[model samples]
Target: MKSFFHVIPVSHVIPANAGILMLVFLGLFCSSFGFATEPQAPRLLEVGVSDVFVPQGFDDNDNAQVVVEGIFPTTCYKLGPVKVDINEDTIKITPQAYFYHGPCLQVMVPYKQEINLGILKAGTYKLNILPDCPENRHTLSIAHSTNSGPDDYLYAPIESARVVSKERPTVRLHGVFSNSCMSLDRVVTHSESNRVVAILPIAKYENNGACLDVLTPFHKDVQIKDPLKGRTLLHVRSLNGTAVNVIEDF
Candidate 1:
């Protein structure tokens, strides 16, 4: 006679280990569901063009003049990195508007509470005091470029650069261009002062499509060349619009 035998599995018999098995399952479930914590990134504050302190920069390609308008918090507050937002219409200034124009405008806010933005472009912006700070101040300026015309076009690109070591020592420039119609008539540099220094052209009328020269950096007023006749190859505006340096034709 065949006798039926009963055999219990070891896993079933070891019921005490069920707790460990449940814990393992629980850990896996937690991991798969992303129960782990993570850190968040900091958000940057946004600023806008509140107003313009000055708006005298010349237009090159479009002969368009830009109006400086600074924008800030309606209430007093700190400041942060300036985010520049521009459109095609607001980007280029028209020649006619140069003579008769309103102030350019923008809005801005502090990314951090400790940041304090001093003077921005003045005539271009309008600000109201906030309860946070009763005394908020700023100024603004413009780096003028020459009026664009057929006779004076094709600005020379900056090919080389050098830093001055002397207190009042002079700096030199050298570069080549694809077109020969342009000349190196002058240069403008931005400095601590708020004036445009006119550096004399060392190499003028370089009809060979390239030129080079040197000029003294002793003047508080710094500007590369004639703004009305030529265009600026390099137009670098400072945090405050009032301070700017231009590399262009006079």
Candidate 2:
């Protein structure tokens, strides 16, 4: 009796080692093709600015108190850290973070935080609200009060000053004044040649007895004799020779 030998095809007979290699290759290919899962985007939380307080006497190196309120979602936990950064005239706030839960199982919670931003100047400041989660940021303009007391005279020139007529060149002066007594005596113009070219007396509040102690708003149209020229400055002074405010390039 003759024993016949069986011949199996190489393609049909896959070795155990080759089977493991093919599985490893398939996994690598799928991962490279982005079959793996991706990370989720951060949740957004609502934040608002309740109030901002800048003390009257705060100088360039004084802290101002800011009150902020917000609501946290139920899908996360509040991480106990708040970061604040103060630039020249800007305040940035970074709120606490939230750890992800399985799902949003609870109701939204309300939270309030008070931050003391140190050493700010007495002027307009920009406050920026930044959160760790993915949400739109916010900005606010706040005016820090000056050190000038209520009794102390304070004046701020209005942004818009107009020359109604160039022929007579009647200048319109507008400003706000606060405190115990202030009078706009005259509008004096100085020329490039360093000479007093024109002196226009403010008719309404000129005399010493004409001064008033209450907060006053002044808008005066004064007539000038000579035409102003060459980088002139108009000085609006009190009767006591103290300059209340000056308008340049008139």
Candidate 3:
């Protein structure tokens, strides 16, 4: 190594202009490490969904919805507005989060968001979740309706739900109705299989008298006596054209 440095001719040495080259190198180095030296503002970034749950089926006039589940790296990350775009046969779903540049706790924050896909013609469609998501492409089938009109009962829109107990778990649901006339009719619990259960809280609307545009809250407690093992999904329907999916592992 000493012989290589010694081989350089004295006349080929860099002149005083080498100061400019050194400054440029230093600028590039600082730019690479600017975050350590300066404060950065919060950024709006997209997070990939871990899982997406779609309802059993949909009709042409029925409202379509899917529940999206994701996780944040830290507690500092807050969930932001979701941007969705549907073009013909494909629906693009982008779940966003707000990342604050400060002291962030090292924890995984799980999140669940519901997206209403609205009505679609009788055909097959694709649900495309944004970049680096698990199973980005999901097939959605919409069947043609032969019924005369829509169903009399609509599912109450649930805000949050949880399993109160593991053994003989009691599912607690809290939601709101659009008007005062709409009330909780009954809680229908259907066990598709051992692990999959669908709870439909049908809302009965009695528009016989004068009804006001009021938001009324409702609560329901569903007891599950059937034996369930492994992963269980409680797909609860919502009146606002959405579904709240609660996944429980026993």
Candidate 4:
């Protein structure tokens, strides 16, 4: 009589390690495919008021020049006329930046332009970049020099504050700095339960010998634990151990 044998398929006799290897390969392939199919964030252009200057004793008709800067991710952008709005104490500008119809290559190009802000009194003025364009916007503080003497300096105050997140309890602040030599050191936040006691390290303007009195914008983000009930007070300090400024009842 002929001997009979049973045939086993190779798939049924696969080793444990082989199965695991196949699963890992599948997972990697799926991950790669997912990444390849994911949509990308649109490249954004950044516009800011780089510098502002006001001559001493300049009246409401003296033309002050403001240097505006733009950082572009692509070369297919055409900058339009910048709209300047002068309020009671604020100067708002909207840069008309838009993308033109063309092929764009990935490269960062920085460009700047000087704008004439019609005459105004010498005092603290806020420069806001209106969010009407498709690109990013920024606000700067124009601090008029004291003109008292060489030692006299003007400090940029905190203009506005808002809570960005509640889970991480992040606070966003907008301010201005006129001194170019000052560097932000750090921000400290003190909290008890839900009430915040203090945010240390206030922002201050110090004469570092090489400072140019040009009004510029500044921003800070502080992260803290979730507050229990009351508001938080925020402070800013410079690298030279100077208390710059603080915002209360934040």
Candidate 5:
């Protein structure tokens, strides 16, 4: 006599995660040019930043200066960290930044020269400086490349939203939506105990929809009233509307 056991294939599970992660990285690289092979140093005069692009092999001690052709060349323009070696004579810039949505970011900072990226590595990056404030209040869409000649990289303005802590007691009504339209009103029941953590109105479109910023009080009843709460389920009166237990807690 012998005991029988079951075995699962490694190729099936591991490959899926790897593929999904690669896709996510590619999407991020496309989104806002989150990876930088070179630094972007654009000088500004009055209102706009110009001449933005890191010199080839720009190092920590490089005094790479690009002529700032603006109305007022004396205006102070804060530079994002990139191993800058700035002096009264020249301003050196390197490529490195950890950008997050915040204040202090207003206009689209343009690059000095058009970049022709050859190859890149697998990592996350941001082109500009992190706004001094927080992500939720930042509204400006900073351009990554300096080219209005139909070959520029333009990032869409993204409004900031915060994520609530899971350790803290909170109630979250998860829902599905498409193109800013509510798909179904399927509010999760038995959503008490947890503070109505955050009613995340996921904007499927590049823009539009109210950003869930106003921290509504922690109440399960009120959470249910959110427009995005029951967005997945149709009315019970409609045909094919089946009552399914979204989630059940003891």
Candidate 6:
């Protein structure tokens, strides 16, 4: 007769605490491999700011604004709100992007956004975009409030714009004036760097008798004739001390 006792292997003998730990380890491992039942959620990520465009100058009453450009590595990204932190003379702008929770196309998308920083007191300020990089930055200068003659006025707010014809290219700007006293005085077009024709629409304020408190709609067409085989940038001056940009292939 042989011994009836059976011996269990050491590997088969798992303590109660070890079993719980193994369960936790398996849970972590599954999560690491995205094997959990939970679905991925959308998120926002900081965009890589490439350049910032600041105005040549600003008056104390001027609404300061800057154009920001950045790139998105994937097509699943959409333009997000800009986070701005102003501390004394230093302004920090963090461009953001919304990431869609799904398989995104591997493509680079360039984006340009205009940030309106309402009137700033007369002073020189440093604008830092993507402070993490420490290189994407620009300076803005705001002149003290000087006597503004009747002839001087800010460009009207450009609500919407478009290039009517690429052949005899003309940019059309449609916007509204604050009141009936304001009117489109003239449109001055000048070609700047990169063959960008800047269309500046100056508004004229009439102080003769009284201006009716009414919103006035105005449409102006600016003729910008140029030959750029690849593309042409239309940097049009608008309200808020900013410029609206329109790209067209000419």
Query: How does residue 73 of candidate 5 score in lDDT?
Result: 27
**Tens digit of lDDT per residue, candidate 5, span 103-150?**
344554432211222222222222331222122221112223343232
Q: Write the per-residue lDDT of candidate 4 for residues 146-181, one digit (tens) a residue.
A: 454322222235565666765666777666666686
TM-score of 1: 0.34
Question: Residue 28, candidate 5: how far off, in angstroms?
Answer: 1.9
TM-score of 5: 0.16
**Candidate order, TM-score descending:** 3, 6, 1, 4, 2, 5
What's the TM-score of each model vs. the native?
Answer: 0.34, 0.31, 0.64, 0.31, 0.16, 0.62
Candidates' lDDT values, in order?
0.33, 0.49, 0.78, 0.52, 0.28, 0.74
Candidate 4: give its CA RMSD in angstroms: 17.0
TM for candidate 3 is: 0.64
Off by over 4 Å in 2: 1-12, 15-17, 20-22, 25-62, 77-106, 122-250
Pairs that collide in candidate 3 are 156-239, 157-239
Report how far off residue 28 is in candidate 6 (Å).
Answer: 14
TM-score winner among the candidates?
A: 3
Q: Which regions of candidate 3 are displaced past 4 Å?
A: 1-41, 134-137, 145-160, 174-183, 191-196, 205-218, 224-227
> Which RMSD does model 3 reach against the true structure?
9.7
lDDT of 3 by residue, 1-250 (tens): 3554546765479866788999888888988988337777779998888776666556777777777777898998998878888788877888888899879899999988867777788888888888765444676778887674663356777887899988887899999877878888888887755656778888777996988888888788898767878767787877765667888886
- Over the stretch 65-118, how does candidate 2's per-residue lDDT look in tens digits? 444555666646563456777677666776655556455668776655545565
Q: Which stretches of candidate 5 lie over 4 Å from their true place?
A: 1-4, 16-38, 46-250
Model 5 misses residue 31 by how many Å? 4.9
Query: Model 4 segments beyond 4 Å from truth?
Result: 1-61, 131-250
Q: Predictions ranked by lDDT, top down?
A: 3, 6, 4, 2, 1, 5
Best by lDDT: 3
Output the better candidate (1/5) by TM-score: 1
lDDT of 6 by residue, 24-87 (tens): 9999999899898687676888887765556545577666677766678888999998898888
